[model samples]
Target: MLALPNYPGDGGGLIVDRAADAPRYEYASLNDCPQVHPDSPNEESTCQHALRDCPPEELGPLLRIWRRTVAGDVVLEPWDSKGLTCASDVAPGARPTLTMADLKAQFMRTPWAKPQVSSQPKGNITLVNLTTFYRVDWSTGGFAPGEVDQSVLRGIPVRIRPKLVGFTYVFGDGTTYGPTVSTGGVYPKGDITHVYRERGEFPTRVLTTFGADFSLDGTRWDPIPSTVTVPGPVTTITVREAQAVLVNH
Candidate 1:
């Protein structure tokens, strides 16, 4: 009887007991094993016969075994054809490969915060030619300077950290401000202010871009060769012409 260790989600281990008079079969890899045809008349009989008679040595290192019950008989099959890896092929302490493409895909899937748009003069309305001071409300998920996400890939621990590259402010009405690293400050001192040339309603928002770094098995950090851009929620600013009126003192 030989017990094979199961892969991550296999549920339980598989115990194989060879019969005394069973025929011996050799297969260099799991791909060489007979594929079960669902509609074949001898489906179970053909594959089961091969599995039962084949020795573990001939099958290479088995990472997972799939067990299926057919007509009150237990039948075993390989979990995945590409899942098998010989123990000798993997070097000890070798890190699992994390490519830039993989990192970019993961970074795109991250639930990053949208830019929180805030403006001075404190309302939806501002005057034409007035410098409408704008800034990202950092407390409301404006930017993530050093955000990290951790996960396990190919049985190895991995870490990914994202750095904010810049912000692109779109003050609708066909005007755009940045790719600027500045988060733009407040009221009197805000660097990201926009002056409305002609008064009307302008839809405004910010886009944040990020570049990332990754680490494997808790090793030193390395940069990922890509960047991801996330768009912020839109906020409308209504600009109108200010008319002066005479008042009695």
Candidate 2:
């Protein structure tokens, strides 16, 4: 609306005629018609321009109740830790409309909570490693407190833990003796030698068999009842008299 140029101080010129919605409109709307911008002095300084509706974070009904609607096209991944999230964007006019049993009941409150994964049961417990090598015989033989004289052996480097998978028992109590080894889970660790044809004190033990189906950190990685106390009376020496008792001691 611009057309006004005819004024000469009332007696020299007069010819003006403007009328077509002058000063009609321009720029405005910070929420003016939220119902008359209720007392908005700074309510985002709104002016109003035919308010263009709101709500839309997916299917806006307040973000579709924190989004969790499940049905056909599925895919919405977020919470991860090998738990795999899934929710493939797809929201449209949602208002109490989510099938698939409401997406399996919101994936059981997601967190991989499917009854804690059917009450734990994963698998893996390895700690039975012993190979075998012996020729131990410093001299004679005649001492059986709890006999295991399978035959003078030698190859010491023992190290076994609750690995899990069969046999597991070793004992020597005197401060815990040492040499009744027999780890399992298909052994593959190392070290095994027991040759004390004349030992005095012995007390070593280590047993295993915590297998009744477990997995949840296996009831706390249980397995620790070790013992070893073997030190004394070994005067057999005969590998050339134990190399002359290690070169005359």
Q: Pick the candidate with the highest TM-score.
A: 1
153-248 in candidate 2: lDDT tens per residue? 112111112222222222231222223333212223323333333323333223322211111112222222222222222222111112224455
Best by lDDT: 1
Put down candidate 1 lDDT per residue, 1-249, tens digits, no spaces. 232333223333532553433322212222112443233342222112222232344432222222322222333342232333323123221122323345457766667767678777788578998888888855344336576788754344567777888999999888898889988877778898889889888888899898877765445666665688888888899999999999999
Off by over 4 Å in 2: 1-83, 86-193, 209-249
Model 1 stretches astray by more than 4 angstroms: 1-98, 138-143, 217-219
Candidate 1's TM-score reads 0.58
Candidate 1 lDDT: 0.58
Q: Estimated TM-score per prediction?
A: 0.58, 0.16
